[model samples]
Each structure stands twice: as structure tokens, then as C-alpha cells.
Target: MNVRHQIKDYIEAQPELKRSDMQELHGIILGIMPDCKLWFLDGRDESGKVVSNPNIGYGVQALKYADGKTREFYQIGMSANTTGISVYIMGIKDKKYLAEKYGKRIGQASVTGYCIKFRALRNIDVDILVDAMRYGVEKTRV
Candidate 1:
């Protein structure tokens, strides 16, 4: 019932290949952010509808909405999707930074403003992914 347990269970519940990949990513993210806060989001809204895939998150960032509402969220987040995985690097001001700086070097991943999505870990460069994550965490510090 704890956040760590929830995150572990989520990763273990993935398909064989994705399970291993998720576990690997979990470990790598923890290694990069040793002692950082950990988070598990079941992808539900206030009404409990499943709006998105569950995510295992690392670090901390306070998100301010247009209505002046604020929510505390993770700086780096990972999730398993139908095709593969998504790693979200949140709070970057420039929407094109990730794509411009790491799109090609990151291999087959899709580098959006704050997300790097790929079919598998082998399809991308792990080092570059780590760099992007580090940047996100540092930039989004509260």
C-alpha cells in the first residue's frame, strides 16, 4: 500500500519484456535521483476516472495552473504505455528544447516538449535520457 510498493507492483505487472524494462528504468531513475521523493499516480482525476496510464515518479515540482491552482508533482516521471514507455521531463520552459537538444541523439524516441516516448529502452540512448532527466529535475526545482 506504500508508494514504493505500488510502484513496484505496477512495474511487475507489465508484460515480460516491458516488466524488465520498467524495472530497469525504475532502478536507473532512483540511481540518478538517490534520496529524491518518489511518487505513484494511478492516473485518476477527482472523480476517479482513468485518464491516463499510471506513473512512477521521481523528484519534485510544484505545478501552477492557469486558474492559480497549484499541485505538487514529480519532475521526472515514467510509465508503460500500449506500445512501449513514456518518460516525462516536466517544467521545461522551451517546448522545443528536448527535441532540439536530444531528439536525434536519443535514438528512436520521440522527444516532445516534456516527454520522451519510445517502444523500448534498446531503441534509445540511456545516457542521453539520463541527461534530459537531470536537466528536468534541476530546472524544475522548487
Candidate 2:
């Protein structure tokens, strides 16, 4: 329910994580975007109880992208895995189009027309991602 609990539960469910792993993941997240707004989402089952799924993850509001009319920016989604971490770009309207365009250049983990998933944080070109986010926010500003 709470962010910390959700994070803790997510970590614990993995079962194979070492203390150093946790620290490394946390540090990596913080290091990636120091000013990002972190939110803990409760992954729930069909009955609404908290559940675990590698697909479900946390989000960081990276930047507010907007133009004079549209106001939607990119919020980065991140998750921890047994081997490494995953980062995804969120808040896109044409996920399908973007996926098709960037899928080859940047790996597409998922594309439900909302979130553009990717691999580990280091795998992505951060400057390009940030610029895209900023442009999205600025382009969509109302």
C-alpha cells in the first residue's frame, strides 16, 4: 500500500537479492535522476490484494513535457530484476508509432500505446531520452 512497503515487498519477492544488490539498485535509481518524482504503486491481484509481477513496476516523473496546447511529458518507469534493472519511458500518446520508429534503435520492452519499455538504465542513451522527454512536455503544453 505504501511506497516503502511496496518497494520492500517487491525486493523481497525476488528472494535471491543480496544486500549489496539492493543498495546498488537504489543507488542507480537515485543516480539516474536525482530530481525525479518517485512514486510507489501497489501491484494488485484480481481480488485487489497486493501482488507481485515483474511486469508491474514503479514510476519516476522525470520531466514535464508540454507545448502551448498539449501538456504531457515523459515519466520514467523503473523495475528491479534478479539480474539487473529495467527502465521505461512513459506518458506517450502514440506509443505504437514511437515503438515502431524507435523500437529498433531503442529496445521496446512493451508498447500498449502508453509506455515504451526498454532495458537497463545504462543501455539507453540518457541524453537522447531526456531531450525527448523535454520535447514531449514542451510540445504538449496547453
Candidate 3:
């Protein structure tokens, strides 16, 4: 299926509450970066083992490895985990930035190096999450 279809399927497969939350977040991210590149990773390794939760991704960022090889990945990603939803803001140089800048102000969520995880939408400030996403996109502009 197409990227949009794949994303829809992923979101719709979630439980009722998570499905709604993911759908809403999908709309908000699209509104923020309408022209961004969309990605659907099925969360499998090359060997076909499921390594992570399926993700709906937005924007583009090239990541360089130690050997000078690079791979392009999403600037922002959203996934539904066993406990809750995770919003990943990739491409930030400073690992501590997210936790330091938005940890206290973003309500009841775990603000990690590159991820903002929460049990539900009501538990965190969606606006601040949006801001962090935008910042991540800007920082990774190519």
C-alpha cells in the first residue's frame, strides 16, 4: 500500500484511545509539515525480525555513521507502545536538550534524549511537543 495507507493502517490497528490519539497527532504533524517526506517503517530488521513498533514518520534527515556512510531517516516519528505513545524528535545534536528544555514544562511525560513519551494526550502539553518537533526539523534541515 501507499505511505498514507500504511500510516492509516498502523494508527487504526491501535486500541480505541490510542488510535484516536495517534490520528489526532498525525493530523497535527501534517499541518506542521505539509510538504515533508512521509515514511512507514514496518519495524523489522533485514532478517525480518520485528525489532520495534511500526512507526509513522515525517520529514527527512541524513544520519552519518562512524564509517562515513549515511542513511536518511525521518525527522519526526510517532509510535504506539505497549504502555503509551512515543513521539520521537530525531536529528538533535545535543542529547540533553529535550529533557532540559521541555521536561518540566511539558507536563506528565518522560522527556528523554530524543523522545517524549506519555501515557495519553491529556497527560502532556501537545503544544510543547509540537514546538520540539518543529525545532528538530529546523535543526536537521538539509
Whose lDDT is higher: candidate 2's or candidate 3's? 3
Best candidate according to lDDT: 3
lDDT of 2: 0.49
- Please provide TM-scores, in order, for all candidate models, with all chains considered together: 0.96, 0.45, 0.97
Clashes of each: 0, 16, 0
Candidate 3: worst-modelled 10 consecutive residues by lDDT: 57-66
Ranking by TM-score: 3, 1, 2
Better candidate number, 1 or 3, judged by lDDT: 3
- For each candidate, what is the lDDT? 0.92, 0.49, 0.93
Please give, for residues 8-43, the per-residue lDDT of candidate 2 as tens digits. 666666545433444455555555556554565454
Please rank every candidate by lDDT, starting with the best.
Answer: 3, 1, 2
* 115 Cα displacement, candidate 2 (Å): 3.4
Instruction: Give the Å error, residue 111, model 3.
Output: 1.0
| Candidate 1, position 34, lDDT | 94
